[model samples]
Target: MNIVVGITGGIAAYKAVGVIRAFVLLGHDVHVVATDAALRFVGRPTLEAISRNPVHTDLYEGVAQVRHVAIGQAADLIVVAPATASSIAKLAIGLADDLLGTTILASSAPVVVAPAMHTEMWVNAATAANVATLQSRGIRVVGPGTGQLTGSDAGVGRMVEPDEIVAAALAALRPRDLSGRRVLVTAGGTREPIDPVRYIGNRSSGRQGVAIAGAAALRGATVELIGANLEVSPPPGVRLTEVSSAAELAAAAATSAASADIIIMAAAVADYRPEITTQSKIKKETQGDRLRIDLVKNPDILAGLASTRHRGQVIVGFAAETEPDDSALLALGRSKIVRKGADYLVLNRVGWTEGFAVPDNRVLVIDLAGDIVMEASGSKLSVADRILDLLA
Candidate 1:
């Protein structure tokens, strides 16, 4: 695969080197293209040394070979990392003043952007509009996650990690691993209605499951994402089925898994629910000293999927255990994998410090055969890729 790495002006410009290294490690041919401002932060010599190709930073430097058109036409994927607000605006408006912009304009290949800027710039009406415009035209945007910025400010404008950006870029360029493959993935924490306005739910934010669906889609799989009331939106190119209760999730999973080649039970479905839901808000009665609500076990979606899995189909389950001893937790996960008849089980420790609702993650992929293919630690997207690689 021929990958073009486009670097724009931003403090995160240095991170683009990691993205290029990931692709190179994966055995893909890589070339670097930098904007004038990007050069200021990351030297041309450094990029050329890493990419093993001449850095292209000029629109007119190589006019005889029409370098911009040539490079763009040869690219399998165009990734713009540390995509500053300025560059995004330029791309949104079809500007071609430099090599990067001109090459982007000429490329027919899939494009992925990793935006990095201040919180205010990201939330600015112009930037938001530009992002919307780009998405409407089928361009992919990875992240500018919420975290500490260059200075005292802290918000959503921090650039996503290089590994994550690389994963998204690879997903864009690779043969859809799920192409012609039907996959059903459950996402988010299921809500067990207790009353008109309240419900029992877990701490799941659904980021991992959404990443799984997005990764699968990139691999050419037809994905049905059975989502609960998630805080975030599902990635583009997925069929989303919304559900609230555990029962609803189970029903959706069952129906979707009927024709699926792979079924991943990633949702943090509630283990129990109230025996009954009140039509109206329950008042705090002054007459009563205390009150209690009876609870009942909810249907086990993972167990059901495992039990009914077709002969050739693959069923993957997830176990989020909070245990002090990592070895014991892994052992328990292995037992669950066998008991549930799942082909693979992803085990991760969840607590106040790590796992659950966080951008980064660490996981162990234990197969039914008791073999560990990957013991990786990184972003959720990287973890998803490791799982997919094992499946492949």
Candidate 2:
């Protein structure tokens, strides 16, 4: 794959080197285009040496071959890591003043930006609006996770890890394993509303589901993500159907799975919901020592989907267990796979060190035939891709 990496001006510009190295290590032919401001942070010689290709920083550097258009048009994927606020705004508005911008303008390949900026800049209405515009056009944004920034301040707007950016870029270029295939993916922990301001939910942060959806889309599948009340944003290009309660998720999953090629029930749906939602907030009363509420079982979305799946369609379910031993955990997954009638099941151990709300994960993919196809221990995206590879 021919990867074109763009580096813009930012304190995080140095991080793009690692991004380039990762792609190169994967045997990708990488070419780099750095903007003038980016050069101030990381010099052209360094990029040239690492990429093993002539680094293009000036739009006029190679006018003989119309280098900007040549580079862009030939790229399999364009990745702009450490994309600064200024660069983001420029790209959003179609600015072509520099090599990076010009190349992007001439390219037909997918463009992915890993943004890095101060919290204030990232949160500004202008930046937010620009990001929305780019996403609406199918441009991919990896991350600006909340963390320590360039300065003493600590908050959102820090760029994601370089390897993550590389993984996302590579995923974009890989064969669409799910192309034309309809996949129904459930995400987030369902929120059972108790009142207007209160709800029953879990600790699920939806990161795993989001990663699955993103990975599925990159494999060329048409994915319908049934998202519960989530704290994080869904990846770009997945069709999202937002729901707040377990009932809503069940309904959505049932409806969407009608035409789906695969159903992945990854959401942490609440087992029970309040029988009756109060019209207003339930206040603490003097006799609250014996307060009680009736609960009802929510619909079983995965079981329901597996029961009526079409011929050849696959059903994948997730099971998060708190078992202490590997044999017990595998046993739990085995039982769930049989009981749920799923074609495959992913067993994840959840606790302070394992799954749930974390970027990395360790999982076992168990099939209905009692075959363990793969045991993954890495980033969620890596696990998701491995699953897709088996399915593909």
Candidate 3:
């Protein structure tokens, strides 16, 4: 998803950085269109670094490329954080005097604005009327919730929090295709303990799984997010269960899967565990660095779910492999699907630089019969929706 975050001048302009970061972390391409005054509060380099895209400010800088409109044309969503009184009035009347104004005018995407100004300014007749006009034009207004204002002031004109803004912005465009469905998702990498202070774990930050859970909630599904050592927070409005080891995850899944309409196993479960865990940390000096720990295979959670799933239930499994050959990757996926008994297997290649904790992912999904069913590559959230499209 391509997101354009418009930052206008205000004390709240600094808050837009959080909004930009939230979008970027969710695997969207964020392009910032900051008013010159907005740049006064937040630095251009900071915006560029967080957005991972160049900041576009000047209306004349890219006139040859018609860049003013191109940014909006490519946008899937536009969010204006700290929309000042002047900016709101300009937006209400469809002003194109600045790049942000022109971008909004050029795009057909939904517009979401979080207003921020002095309480008096926000409550003024002109500001209230401008807000009403924007809302009337199908614009989504998140909030100018009552809270702290600039120095020595507090009122209802503060910008809403970044997370709330992101949620509202995404919700404005989301379709509830999974309404009335129950979804169970397992995310993050499970950790198996070796001793009191030592443990074996994978580098799965649970990003991919978290995205699936968040996307499911956005689609109007009743979401149960069972996270295993999650490195990131799950989106709002989902039932969250935190677990650690593979056994813990298996237990939780068994208890939850019975009622779920769709079960997505995105957690990277450890295949093996220490057969005997020490009561205390193993001292390296005492062991002379020659200690060996026995291993035992963990239960196959996906297979168990597939075997016991009720009719009309769907089970999706993920396979993160390191094979470089495309043919080999697909072969591995085909074999895993058969072995796991999952309805669909999402196969992704992961290495030191790709997959795992990254925001984006590339996956090939195959069904029970080893037939390719879906191929998706993009931000994890986008990939997640494509996966959900299969069920929807």
RMSD of each: 11.7, 11.6, 2.2
lDDT of each: 0.87, 0.86, 0.94
TM-score of each: 0.63, 0.64, 0.92
**lDDT of candidate 3 over 1-392, digit per residue (tens):** 78999999998999999999999988788999999999999999999999999999999998889999999999999999989999999998888999999999999999999999999998899999999999899999988899888898988898989999998898888899999999999999999999989899999999889888888888899999999999998888799999999999999999999999999999999999999999988998999959888999999999999999999999999999999999999999998999999999999999999998888899999999999999999889889989999988
Of the two candidates 2 and 3, the one with more favorable TM-score, higher being better, is: 3
Whose TM-score is higher: candidate 1's or candidate 3's?
Answer: 3
Ranking by TM-score: 3, 2, 1
Instruction: Residues 118-195, candidate 1: write the lDDT tens digits.
Output: 999999999999999999998889998999999799999999988788768777666665679888888899999888
Model 3, residue 292: C-alpha shift (Å): 2.4
Worst 10 residues of 3 by lDDT: 166-175
- Model 1 ranges with Cα > 4 A deviation: 1-77, 80-171, 286-289
Please give the range of 10 consecutive residues that has the lowest summed lDDT in model 1.
20-29
Instruction: Pull out the clashing pairs in model 3.
Output: none
Instruction: Please provide, for model 2 over 1-392, each residue's C-alpha lDDT reduced to its tens digit, 9 standing for 90 to 100.
Output: 68899999898999999888766644468999888888899988888888888888888878999986999999989999989999999988999988899899999999999999999999999999999999998889999998998769899999998867876776766786677888888889999988889898887888788778877887888888988977777876689999988888888888888899988888898989999998988887843867577899987778888888889999899998889899988888888889899999999899876788877789999999777878987777667777778788
Tally clashing residue pairs in candidate 1.
6
